[model samples]
Target: MSNSIATWMGKGHAAVEAPIGDDGFCFGSEPSLADVCLIPQLYAARRFEVPLDACPRILRVEELAGRHEVFGSAHPSVQPDAE
Candidate 1:
């Protein structure tokens, strides 16, 4: 990968491993901004083959979001304009 690409992916990896709940945001409730961002990011991470096992909070949030009806609403396949 190019230096820029490596740097970018490195940043993402850092984000995935960073501590959660460190900013006083409640994750026990409905998903927050971090949860929202992490979903698509993890999707990309999987496609890009980035190691995410270190990001426990993201996996937990994703697993929780995956279990609920609310997550379905945000699915691209279910979008009103989706193909």
Candidate 2:
């Protein structure tokens, strides 16, 4: 979580890679809830400190997701206006 956001910090960035399961996995595939759970926690992770460069794949997914409407609605800053 914390690690995911730091990748966006720019100059000071470092990616944190996670282990693909022994079941065999690779980069650039459909993400799981594990990926879904990352972005918000990344906010907190930035507040603290987490390495990013270790996980370039996750960050790439983060960027790709950001371009989608679904991701936009899910973001706290994009919440619906109160009725």
Highest-lDDT candidate: 1
The C-alpha lDDT values of all candidates are 0.64, 0.53
* Top-TM-score candidate index: 1
* TM-score: model 1 vs. ground truth: 0.63
lDDT for each residue of candidate 2 in 1-83, tens digit (9 for 90 to 100): 44445545533333223443322112335546655666665545545676455556556666756766676778766667623
What value does the lDDT take at residue 77 in candidate 2?
A: 64
Instruction: Note the residue pairs that clash in candidate 1.
Output: none
Off by over 4 Å in 2: 1-16, 20-28, 49-51, 80-83
lDDT of 1 by residue, 23-79 (tens): 322254666776777677766666566666666666666777777687768866688
